[model samples]
Target: MELKAISDDEKQRYKTVVLKFLEDLSYNLDDKAIINYINKLKKEFAPKTARMHIIRIRAFLKFIDHPIANLIELPKVPKRRRRLVIKVEHVRDLLREIDEKLSGPYRLKLKSAVLLSATSGLRAEELYKLRLEDIDLENRTIFVRAEIAKDYEDRVTFFSKEAQDVLEEYLNTFKPSNPLFSKKSLLHQFSKLDTRLRMKHMRKFFSQQSDRLGMPTAVKKILMGHSTAGDVDLSHYDFQDEEELKKIYDEYWKNFRILG
Candidate 1:
């Protein structure tokens, strides 16, 4: 049952075949004969969308105890990557595409949400889950607890000057302590407005600004609260020097640049 213990042949004959079987089952049994088809639906879509379907099918196979039920090959699909850092100019185009004709609270909410996620690297879920207390205006940082971050690691996110300005406006003027975007779902509501703002797009927007600002990759990763790539364990040291994290976080904010 451990992955390392499974022989290559067993993986091929059992795991690979099991995956194909589940795909065939989901596809063939679909009521419309194309109802649950991923390939049919994903011509221009990211492969990860299709991969999610595969994951659902895998979960179903496990639940049902089908052939090769205990084994599954990891499906090869494109990952939904975060955006590379760029400047505000690139995001300006996207903002134009949005309901630019609209202004005031709705506009502020949209811009603030997008900018915070882009600059601070908050996940869409984290944005939704963020509390008023999470943002420290005096410190110009956003703290994500272990429960909210993608990884279990805790990190404080720094904000750009413009981001701080907009957030301050949002915090001081409207929806002071409420959810930044109070809808059940941002994309869902935007769907009605004919503007679907996805997490991927938000990251892409962030990356463009970050890239333009000439942010270092390491800083980007750190701001995003991702675990570093190398074998070095900064977490261990941070654990011992918990107070140091706040210092580092504040230092990072001290150098942050905002866009016009």
Candidate 2:
């Protein structure tokens, strides 16, 4: 599943299958034992979960066979794609809760990371690809290079004082030249505490914030990294000045109490 890398519960599923079929088992009971295991799982879990559990078991059982019993066959359950995405409010809550509960550098880093994503509409991959050079604190701009972006185009996004302060503090304490968005980019000291939050929720929350602020449709689209194929280019239109952009960003942060 696509969630294996991120899902907290997936490791147990993989281990159960490998451990059951490959470890200290008699050859003659293979087929019946596999069937019995499936039955037991079916009784204990829902049909859907039973199927998922079976996949892991079957994958490991594919090569092994018993001397007297025929090998068990697995049912191929059609994979269901997860369409549910985290809501914007949830993202806001996550950041808020983390800010209130988490302590020290880890707290500031997470607060800044999620806030940056929500405000700038950066993707998880984009967050991981950030470089120290990408952000210009003096100029108050973040340069998202084309190579790391899906559209193969460069874009500039601005930051708020809270983000700037956290980042500046982080930069002052940690010297990193390579990856900007990953946990390792923070510092060896924070490595133990870094908990990588998904970036998609940040983008979603940003969109909601933009909507609440009555941000122009075009500006919202650009901020969300969505461009209409036939639409006129935004850069070709009149662009707002840095001061105007700052007002919008500041107001957004103000509402969330992130300005403090």
Best by TM-score: 1
Q: Which ten residues in a row have the lowest lDDT in candidate 1?
A: 29-38
Q: Candidate 1 on 57-88: residue-level lDDT in tens?
A: 55555666655434544446855676445445
* Poorest lDDT segment (10 consecutive residues) of candidate 2: 186-195
TM-score of 2: 0.54
Clashing pairs for model 2 are 130-180
| Number of backbone-clashing residue pairs for each candidate, in the order shown | 11, 1
What's the lDDT for candidate 2?
0.62
**lDDT scores for all predictions?**
0.60, 0.62
Question: Candidate 1, which segments miss by more than 4 Å at Cα?
Answer: 1-55, 68-87, 95-99, 183-185, 192-199, 205-214, 233-259
Candidate 1 TM-score, true structure as reference: 0.62
